[model samples]
Target: MRKRTVGTGILVACAVGLLVYLAFNVRLAPIPNAVAALKTVGMTCGSCAGKIEKALKPMKGVAGVEVDVKGGWVLVGYDTNSANPETFAGAVRKAGFQSWLMEQMSLADFRRVTGRDFGAKVVRSGGCGTGGCDSGGCGNAI
Candidate 1:
């Protein structure tokens, strides 16, 4: 009788442990697919980036926000089910910054404004006329 009771208690303990393990290991739903990038204009300094980041950070469904001062762009990652690009654009405009959907801008214009070179450099050692490059290399200034 004693051996049977001990065996039954061990079985119950094992069952409870398995249930707990399964509960913790179960996978949840996948994250939504509403991520997008926005290009902001008229941002001249780091302070401008801070203002834009602060404005968008509090909005719902915003997963992440990055402001590139040199690139004059704001990249936003969001959940489409909860928020849309139009809403995000509105938030940027309200902060006194000009913003447009990244898709609207032409690739050529983006490269020009950001000062990014897509092709080989004509001068290997010399910097661009815009003073973006120096002895250290190309600075982040755009």
Candidate 2:
């Protein structure tokens, strides 16, 4: 009789714990102070942008993602402590797209040149072959 009462109490406690876990939403702190601008190859359209975002969005400490199809570049805003230019570049590589890091700049410079916050806008234009390198072969991807 006592064992049954104890087991019932344990089950109720577990149920309550599970409910609390389901009810609370996990919050990730945004790290938005630095930007990693990378030059990409073989990225030709908005679909390419989506792929890049998919690769980068789940990375820890990444705050924002922006892709410029017209320019063949991807800009990632992230927390310096948790991610760096290499983290973004490596993820793109794993996603099967190659990337060359252009520069890592401060959020101020990024906003100044882009005129907006990361993920707030994207530059999608230019024809394929012109999209990533080969604008008469842009720098030969060197």
Candidate 3:
């Protein structure tokens, strides 16, 4: 009985040590940028929003993503220097949607008006009439 108890204690200690080692060694990737917003088109339903969110969330440098179907926008939080904004538009395009960077003030004001919370930093923006672009504009300046 004494030997069996000592063996169990050793096993438990080993398991605990392994868990602590793994926890300390595991390194999570850092988030790349602050919050950013992109005006999107063709996201008329929940599925569309989900598809876009799925595509963008896994991208490197992207920390978090929120898709607003009603507002037709996607807000992202990331590290600016590491994040490639073009990748965001590309993901949207791949998901069969169109997207563009909304002007800083325009996005902030829109968020305020719509009562959306993203806490974005406004990395870049397209001017007036640039929101919700289609294939003709190709997610760029017209």
Q: What Cα-based lDDT does every candidate model obtain?
A: 0.61, 0.76, 0.66
lDDT of 3 by residue, 30-122 (tens): 554356678997664555666777888778777667777667888776666677766787887877778887633333454666576454432
Q: lDDT winner between 1 and 3, please give it.
A: 3
lDDT of 2: 0.76
Backbone clashes counted, model 3: 5
Best by lDDT: 2
Model 2 TM-score on a 0 to 1 scale:
0.68
User: Which RMSD does model 2 reach against the true structure?
Assistant: 6.6
Tens-digit lDDT track of model 1 for 1-142 = 9999999999999999999998998644323244456777766555556667788867876755667656666766556667666777778888877787764223355356547432222112122343534543333422
The residue ranges of model 1 lying beyond 4 angstroms of the native Cα positions read 1-32, 104-142
Q: Which residue pairs collide in model 1, if any?
A: none
**Best TM-score among the predictions, by candidate number:** 2
Give the per-residue lDDT digits (tens) of candidate 2, residues 64-120: 888886667888888888876787888888877788788998888878987877767
